[model samples]
Target: MDDHRIFAESLAAALAAEPDVDVSAAGSGPAALRCLERAAGEGRRYDVLLVDADLGGHASGSRPAVPVQDGDEEGLVDGISLVAGVRAAQPAVRIVVLAEKDDARRAALALQAGASGWVAKDCSLSRLLTVIRGVLRDETHLPPALLTGVLRELTAARRHRTESERLVESLTPREREVLRCMVAGLGRKAVAERLFLSPHTVRTHMQNVLGKLGVHSTLAAVALARRAGVGPADLTGDVVERGSQLA
Candidate 1:
């Protein structure tokens, strides 16, 4: 039997061990595509596509994790990309990426690109089988370590973007001027003098800017302004390093 057939047999055997599962396997992206196409044509559909990250490629000699490639730009086929391609070809099928521990980033990318779930290949056979079944049932199964990291990064990026937009929308011309001066490390009195306004007016504008930004102080306002993409040239000096603790 060919490698495809062997892989299919192994997968079949694994599924057979689980009495509740009834899985059919396809060896390659093209074969999987055809399977889905035929199923759709006949008004049928498979539950999921479990894709191995390194398919039809040799492992790198130096780094076991890497794949050997023929060219630089047109690199070797990655399993996550294959999942994306399968989803593109068969919009009706759910895709699950089977990747190694080091491929967590790639797996995360796959999820962002529309894969339903990611399972680490090194997981126990029972866990792997269970995750596959879960994916088939349209559920996401991620190891706790990987899931936490992915959630943290995604949340941080989202908050950064949101705060940036709000800060821009809330800034008035005079307040923006005061912010620029404050960011330059100037004291309240100096900022008022530079803008030719009363100290009380400067303090009032600073309070409004802070309240609108939902930040505690002028230093935090400056930091939020910078994160919101306000250029340093537009402002005066370096922003205070108030750690990014979202209120």
Candidate 2:
């Protein structure tokens, strides 16, 4: 699963040099899926798949190069996105993603999507082979450089989510209604109309929401609200808040 045919095929040739490794290259996400499907149908399943993290770009290749369109299962465009699809085709397959740059964010996504590991595209051949073999033994592998980053990335995301939920929970019932309106892209005046409140009252509620969310703008408020799983105006339920509701 890479768009660069030379890189894909060259890597494939190198891996095939191993006496026990049977490897082939696919230049696009679709092509990879096809290979998996065909192999499964023939009852000759592959044991491993190495994919490029950044696929579907402006790269020339002899193999079929397909752009990562806003297509393919909820806009799956890159090797990280292709992880789930690969698992669907061959549940037993071990996937190791290759990235030109090491990214903890992308690595977290790959792991969550069922990839066994991720590695640098420029990693040494020996390390690459070691990772491939490691996954076969059901070991989750990552380069030492990415271990701390991925751990911190995941931890920070979790902490932020908890804080956001707590902040959203702190809002009064009326304040929650205002925050939901913000998420719907509603202006204070529009929110007033929808909620049957005076514009002055809407402004006050909006200010309170901003203050509670620790943000200075409506866009920031909406972003935090989304992180807290706040739905649109129509989807929000009027809930009663205790102690902090100076309503």
Candidate 3:
């Protein structure tokens, strides 16, 4: 989806002119998600989605046609996040990110979010169409200029994730639980209540976790846990039962 109406419509028209293409356009991330949902409901899913890399976050005038459902992903704060949202909703659809310029960092993130191709918006229509066809055939495409930097960015992320996982692996099971609660933004008292431990015991566990993770502060530990793919403990359910399961 693109916020620029003129570009969206013109590109749609151009693609529609092709003998084997069917094109649709949306001017905002919410509108784009709506289109995907509607198409899925009708049993006619889109084969490819070309998304503006900067939609939702800084669109000049994005007017979603439908009222957003409460707690829907906020029309995607940025295109990278929208790529992830679309991937979650439609796993089979090939996604291509359209950016204003070649950004290796954003392109790497887009690839991680399931985009099969990344291209500059100023690229020729013929080039974009070719990439679309290529992705449909299960080939990934990236601009040549972006190859080196994108690879570097992805490698660095991988290294961080690996190191974070190693540090997290060093914690004891109880320490790990305490760390999970900490990542959820729970205080020592809250963690004690949820985990059914005494507050002093919780404090000891938290300190042990920080020491094991080799972090000086809770915030640094939280960041490391996230890099390790550790998510917060669910706090909404019955805490008594939840704590029992962990036992």
Candidate 4:
């Protein structure tokens, strides 16, 4: 036994019913890490690590600590980070993220961060057990709805990366600069001002970029630019654009 009393209890109960498996529990990320470290130190290792995404550390005075906001430099240890840490420490261990019903975004991030699979907490205990066993066997155990979303995002990201590389290869240096501005949602006049070109020249480049991208409108051009990895930082100068399109 290590720490997650609730999940550990449930898993223990399930494994008890099975009679062929041994299950252990940990309450916090640090405890889980410690358990793994000790097991490794003792030349023992578990088959898998199932991490809950919302273990908000220890509750102090009846309320749990709020999670750190996105991009926080302190690097808060949510479930995803916990699993990443575990993987870093024990690369051979399989990891499964236990997410909430609406955790599609977090689940996608987890997969990108190297989690083997994701299971929603709302699923049945039997389903959870099955997923746990499946992940232990080096198999994917994603729920159907979550699997669909993950696959869609993965495909979209791949397409965007591929299209961006092609655009970079096809465009001239100046055209690439204009496309970067467009990706930042800048208009013709704004792009011209940033590049020290006339508005007419900017418009001409925009049209050429659009034709090269096979897009029909400024909006479509911007969408294609984002897929090419053109962000505000890629802009020629500090031109603040409105209504940026993100992929």
Candidate 5:
């Protein structure tokens, strides 16, 4: 949700022009929630949501003060709050925060709220669309810079790569192969094709991967793996060779 009516409408229009896509717009967080409810009532659900960091200007008088964590200093309207609210409403909907600038705090907050992606507002529509598709395929768009900071933030809360590493150790060889492809942003069919496996086999591997990782979704598994440094960068030829050597 955003306060800018023109910008929101323009974005919705552009997205609607894409093939096999439907677009809807809301100027505020509550409005967006209402739209989601209405869509659900009609047996429809959104796969992704693009939320503005700032929901809008003050409704009538005072700007809303967002709740912050122990170390957070700012009390202004935090878009991360909206991300959490949206997650509460629709746990399955992937969320991408539209940031006005590249702020580390904003990125960290979004990640902490379980947002799937974040993109600067000034980024090209093509980039945003790519991010949307990527997130839908369970890819996190966190740049290395932001990821470093987010890792530190999570570290402070006793939730960091160490935990992910522990979980990773529990994965089977086949499950690690599945996770490797997943971290590379491959969908189930693509992963199955690449691994020379049937779709049913891929699904089973994915479920085992999720269970071993102690996560509910593929995105969470990939995120945890990346946080533990078992990301696309680590899925090198040597890694592939190791997987192949497995019985």
Candidate 6:
């Protein structure tokens, strides 16, 4: 959804022109929510939602938008909250943030709120379509400019390794081994074979890894591990170092 009806409708129309594409538009977050609710009641699910990051401004063909403050989850005036709301209602649905500016902070907030991807307003229509399709395939489409900033922010939040080290300490020896394999780009079956464990055991360890890292995806967990200096080469030594504590 966007605050400007003309932009939203124009974009929706352009998308609708594509074969096998069904597109809709909303002028505000509330309208979008209402639309989602109605669709849910009708047993119709949306494949993806495109929401503008700064939706608190005036909406075209609708009432003045509600003002949303930063970090307000209940307020539907902004994309972050809308993303969270949509995620809460439909865990499997993919949401993409549409931003007029490359504001890293806003992009970070939207992603943290469960947005699967983001698109800059200045991007071409083809690019937006590609992002939507990529998100549908479960690929995160973070802009390179935003991704560098997001990674920096993520790494900067913990200058010292104390917190990350503590999180790593929480993992079992088996889980640490699984994470090490993950950092090396091993699939679950590969990790299982390498670790001499059942595939089911490997899956369980992967779940534990995600839990300890407080991330949803293995890619995210691996990134956190690399940032925390827990690369594959260090995995064996790190496990030994944490052995006494785990015991």
Best prediction by TM-score = 3
TM-score of each: 0.49, 0.58, 0.82, 0.53, 0.54, 0.55
Off by over 4 Å in 4: 1-4, 56-78, 159-247
Write model 6 residue lDDT over 81-190, tens digit each, in one string. Answer: 56776787777767787776787777767776788777777899889778877777789998887888987765665554567777888888768767878988889987
Candidate number that wins on TM-score, 1 or 5: 5
Ten residues in a row with the worst lDDT in model 2? 68-77
Q: Candidate 1 residues 115-141, lDDT tens each?
A: 777776666778866665565566887
What digit string (tens of lDDT, one per residue) describes model 3 on residues 115-200? 89898888897998788778777899999999999999999999999999999999887788788889999999999889888899
Over the stretch 166-244, how does candidate 5's per-residue lDDT look in tens digits?
8998988778878889999988897776776779988998998998888999889888998776856243443343235
Question: Candidate 1 clashing pairs?
Answer: 183-237, 184-236, 184-237
The CA-based lDDT of model 2 is what?
A: 0.71
lDDT of every model, 2 decimals: 0.59, 0.71, 0.75, 0.62, 0.67, 0.67
> Better model by TM-score, 2 or 4?
2
TM-score of 4: 0.53
Best by lDDT: 3
Query: Which residue pairs clash within candidate 2?
Result: none
Deviation in Å, model 5, residue 179 alpha carbon: 40
Q: After superposition, how far is residue 153 of candidate 3 from its true place, in Å?
A: 1.3
Q: What is candidate 4's local distance difference test score?
A: 0.62
Which residue runs of candidate 3 sit more than 4 Å off their true CA positions?
1-3, 56-78, 235-247
Query: Where does model 1 exceed 4 Å of error?
Result: 1-5, 56-79, 88-92, 152-247
Clashes of each: 3, 0, 0, 5, 0, 0
* Model 5: colliding residue pairs: none
Model 4: weakest 10-residue lDDT segment is 66-75
Rank all candidate structures by their TM-score, best first, as comma-separated numbers.
3, 2, 6, 5, 4, 1
